[model samples]
Target: MLIGEVARRSGVSARMLRHYDTLGLVRPTGRTVGGYREYSPEDIRRIFHVEGLRSLGLSLSQIGRALDEAGFTPSTLVGDLIRKTEERLNREQELLERLRTVDAAEPSGWQDVLRIVELLHGLGSQSAARRLQAVLAPAEGVSVPAEMLAEAVLTESDPNVAGALRWALARAGGDGVASVASGMASEDVDVRRRVVLALAELPGDEATVVLTDALGDPDTTTRRHAALALGARGVTQAVPELVGTVLTGPNDVEAAELLGTLAQDAKWADRIMSALVYGLTAHAADSAVRMRLTQALAEMPGTTALDTLRQLSRDDDRAVALIASALVEKLEKRLDDELGQP
Candidate 1:
């Protein structure tokens, strides 16, 4: 077949076929009397082969090596293509996420779009300071959408930057609650923990509801944080976890203090006291735990807690006895003072 016939039948353009010939990718196998290029059957087959390889993202040089080099294997080149394709796909995905975030911001104009983009870039920067600045920079005039801040709060690992992001999310109010709440379903313990912390800072029934649900999280840290946040919100449902926190610790003091505050409510007072007393009884064999529980009892109000304190004041452990006795004295003195005793 002549070049024209080859181009017609194979759909390879004449110019590209000539270029392929010049590059020795698919040279014509013969020539006619007029000296025009003529392609044999094998040559046309090679042309198809080159086009086939190009479809797989092979560069011209790589294709040349693939076609001509006897030692060249498709395995290594195909592996490289897979990696590069994955990288391109990841880049596209990130771009799409960024676009969606920007669109969610509902920017008013090109300037707003640019500012949000800049803020996103800064948040993803390698430098922690830049991330911190990106979170705080919006206060100058730009209004960062709550969803964006919630996303940052979920992924941030730096303590200072994470704190700022939480503050910013909180200041943004209930708008970011859904975004932060989504992180609660993550299988990662740290992610769930971070979500709880972020939700704790956020104010609204939405955040409170999510924190209440998080009370059942399998991770202890996540459960504790959620319980504390719910306790502060006066949810009363946090009593179990807060009491458990008192029995076994990480933030036992804080938990105890919140339990004390919760006990101030008349309806929850006995329930909270009962849970604390149970902890004291259940953990009687563990002196340290008993001691912590004893101290936590000091936070409760009403005669029940005072009675519990009076009973613990003569306990088996000398340390528990001493601490409970001291707390008993303080509680009596405070009670006396309330009653206007001399």
Candidate 2:
């Protein structure tokens, strides 16, 4: 079959078929004398497998390797992929557990829906606009309860939610809802906290500005939540304040744990080490925070950071010793891997 007929039959686009050919995922079994490509039934069958694996988030490279390693079927490789996915899901679950107490996830209120929808009215974002359409799509004839509709929107893809609400608001044609969102952005404490949280789930210049302001909120909970939300949003505007807060602020435990978890650039290691040193000198009020910082310090590959961590190996906390043991094992593995030693 030609590419178009294959696309019609298999539902994978011709471009994607060409991509698969390039990736060695599917290949033409033969070519005509005039140079037209011809695919066998076997090639079409393999394309179906390729489509399924792509849907499961396997990269072309990964799918190729898996196909070579397993006997062309993912069932043999699915167990390994499932295990890796489970590990990632476990880490996310743990983070969610820790964050739940810090900030509660409330059901979206009427004003919340109104604000999201109205923002979409002026919505310039293509991604947010598309999301808004999907949410209000079922609203054509079926009257889903307001709360249920809000929940459905909230749970939908983030962009679609933004798009749907904006579409709804544009259709409704109201400025009053914008006033509500803008007013909430100016409020102090809980209202601002909730606004920042909701904005974290949204995408816009306004949400970015609101988040920037929320990080400076007088309430510690609000500030902490803002920091966390902004970090998840990848808004670099909060990094400096978040770093400063983690090093010197009152919420020592949460800040330390987050900094340890989030900070990746080696350039920030010195600043983090200084903060850990300060925490160690003062001694953490929370043992868990102290242990986490100690572990983070141990993760640094430098001699100075290792020496500092080693000095604390005799501390009352057994977790510190375990971290040191792990660090030593890591160093040994690095030497073995680099030196090609057994």
Candidate 3:
């Protein structure tokens, strides 16, 4: 076959075939009387082989090595191609995400587009200050899309920047809830923790629902954060975790305070008291836990909590007895004051 026929059959353009010949990638096996290049059957097979390697993302040099080098193996090169393809895919995915976020912003013009793009770059910047500024203050009149803020909050590592992003996400209202909620499905504990934190700031039933689901998160920290947020919103579902926090804690005091606030509701009061009493009984050997529980019990209203405090005042542990005794006195005084007793 001549170059024209070879090009017609193989789909390799004659110009490209000539280029391949120049590079010694696939030289035609013979020549006609007019000195035009002619390809033998074996030469046509080599052309297809080169095209096949090219389809796998092989550079011309790599293809040359693959076709001609005796020791060349597909294993190492294919592995490298896979890695490079994965990297390219990742980059493309990131770009697609960036474009989607920008489109979600619905920029009215090129200026708005540029400002939003700048704000996004700032949010992803390595400098914590830039990330903070991006959330706290964006370009004039450029509204940062809640979706962008949601994405940033999930990956933000700096404490200050994360807090700012959460605050901004909350102020963005329930608009960002779905985006933040989607992150809850992540197997990454840190990401889920951030998701709950962001959801906690977001108001409305959407965020509340996601937070309620987070109560059962496998990650302890994620659960605790979710519980605290739910408790603040007066979600009674947080009671068990709050009670658990009082039993064993890093933020026992906060948990105790929020539990007390929840106890203000007449219906939940007894339940809250019962959980606390159960905690006191379950952790009988853990005096420190008992002490924390004792303090928490004082936050409850009505005679029930007062009676519980009176009973604990005479407990075996001297420290428990002393703390409970002090709390009992305070509770009595408060109850008396409420009743207008002399």
Model 3: weakest 10-residue lDDT segment is: 298-307
Candidates in order, TM-scores: namely: 0.85, 0.41, 0.93
Residue-level lDDT of model 1, residues 18-122, one tens digit each, is 999899889999998999999999999999999999999999889999999999989988999999999999999999989988898788888888888888889
* Per-residue C-alpha lDDT of model 2 across residues 220-270, encoded as one tens digit per residue: 677766786676655555555555555455554555445554445566666
Q: Looking at model 3, how many pairs of residues clash? A: 0
Tell me the whole-model lDDT of each prediction, alpha carbons only. 0.89, 0.58, 0.89
Error of 1 at 198 (Å): 0.7
- Ranking of candidates on TM-score, top first: 3, 1, 2
Model 3 / residue 35 / CA error / Å: 2.6
Q: How many residue pairs clash in each candidate?
A: 0, 11, 0
Report the Cα lDDT for candidate 3: 0.89
Model 1 lDDT-worst window of ten? 136-145
